[model samples]
Target: MTEITPRIPPLPRAEWTDDAREVFAYWGEPNAWEEGSKTNILMTMGNHPDLGKVYNIWGKHLLMSNTLSTRHLEILILRVAWLVKSAYEWHNHVGYGLNAGLTLEEIGAIRDFPAGDDWNEQDEAVLRSVDELKNDGVISDATWAILGQYFDMRQKMDLVFSIGHYVMTSWAISSFGVGIEGGADQIGFDLRTASGKIPGKTYKPGEVEDWTDTRGY
Candidate 1:
C-alpha cells in the first residue's frame, strides 16, 4: 500500500473531470513505447504547462534519444524510485526496467542500492554512480572509472542528467500529491527508505529533495 501522507494532498475527485478522464484514458494506453501505467499518467499529467516543459526537456535530454541505453536509463529511474520510496514511479518503472534488460533480482536489489546483493562489478558501478550523483552533485572517481568501461561521454552525460531529471519528477509527484496511477502495483512495490532525501527541492522547503542547485544534478 502507498503511504499517502503526502506533502500535498490530491485534488478532490470532484475536481477530476471528463477532460481529466480523457487524459487518463489516453495515458492508460501502452502506445508510448514501453511505458507502463504510472509513467504514462505522470507523462500525461506533466502535460499541464510548466511541469510539461520540464518533463519534455528532461525526457529529450535523457530518454527520447540515445543517452544511456534504454536499459541503463530504466535502471537509473528504478533506483531513484526505490531510494525515494516513490511507489508510483517504482511500479511503473520496474516493468520497463525488466524489459530494458534488468533482471528480477536486480530490480529487487534496487530497493537497497548502496548495499544491494548479486550485483556484478558493472551493476555496482551504475548503482554507485547514481548514488554519487544524487549525493555529491557530481560523479565519483570510483564510479566514473567503472562507467567508462561500458559507456561513452554522451552516455555518461545522459545518465547523470537522467538521474537529476527523475529526481525532480519523483520529488514533484511526491510533494504535489499526485496519486499513484491505478494498477500501478500490478508490477508491485517494495517499501524502501522513504526517509532517504533526494538532493533537490521538493515543493516544500526543508523537504525531501532540495532543488536549489543551479544545475539539475
Candidate 2:
C-alpha cells in the first residue's frame, strides 16, 4: 500500500502542554512526552489533550481491565483491525496477538475468518459476531446464543464494547492518517508478503519496562 501522510500530525513533543503530557503519561510511562509513546496513536491524540485524557481511561479498561481474556481480546481486536483495514491497529495488535498466544496461522486466519479450520466453537462464534455486527449492526440471535455458552454477562458486554471501541479507533486512525511509527516496512499487513513473518516489535505480556508505574492500579 502507498504511504499516506498524516492529516493530523502527532503533537511535537516540544509543543505538548501540561495536559498533553498528562494524557500521554496515562499509558504508564517514563513520561510519554519526554520519551514518546510506543506508537504514534497517542501522540496524534495529543493534538487534543482533553479528549486524549478521557479516551485513555476507556481504552485502558478495555486493554488492561476488561473481562475478556487476553486471547479473546486480541482475536476480536485483530478481526476489527482487518474489517476496518486499519493497518496501524493491525500492525500493533499482531504483536499483541502473538503475545496473547495466537499462532501466526490463527492471526492470518483473522483476515478471512471461518474460511480457515483453525477456530474452534467459541472462537468461531466470537469471530462471527464481529462480522455480524459490522454487517448488520447487531449480533444475531444464533451468534449471541453461542457467545452465551462461554462468556458471562460482563464478558458479553465487554465483547460488544470492545468491537465498538476498535471500530471507532480505526475510524480515527484512518481519518487522521496515522502511519506506522517507524515506516511502511513496519506495517504488519503486506499484500506482497502476506504469508511472511509479521513485522514490528513484539513485547512479552506486561513488558512495559519503561512504564513500570501502573499509577496505583
The candidate that achieves the highest lDDT relative to the unseen native structure: 2
Which segments of candidate 1 are over 4 A away from where they belong? 3-50, 114-116, 186-188, 191-217
For each candidate in the order shown, give its overall lDDT on alpha carbons: 0.59, 0.79
lDDT agreement of model 1 with the native: 0.59
Where's the lowest-lDDT run of ten residues in candidate 2?
A: 208-217
- Report the lDDT tens digits of candidate 1 across residue range 1-217: 5545544443234444444443433322333223222333334453353544455545554654756667667778888887776766775566556556667677777777656677777767878877887778888887889889988988887777788878887888776766554433334454332333222211211112431121121
Across 71-166, the per-residue lDDT of candidate 2 in tens digits comes to 999999999999998987887787778777887778878887778656789999999989999989999999999999999999999999999999
TM-scores for all candidates: the values are: 0.66, 0.87
lDDT of 2: 0.79
For model 2 the TM-score comes to 0.87
Q: How much does candidate 1 score in TM-score?
A: 0.66
lDDT of 1 at 203: 21
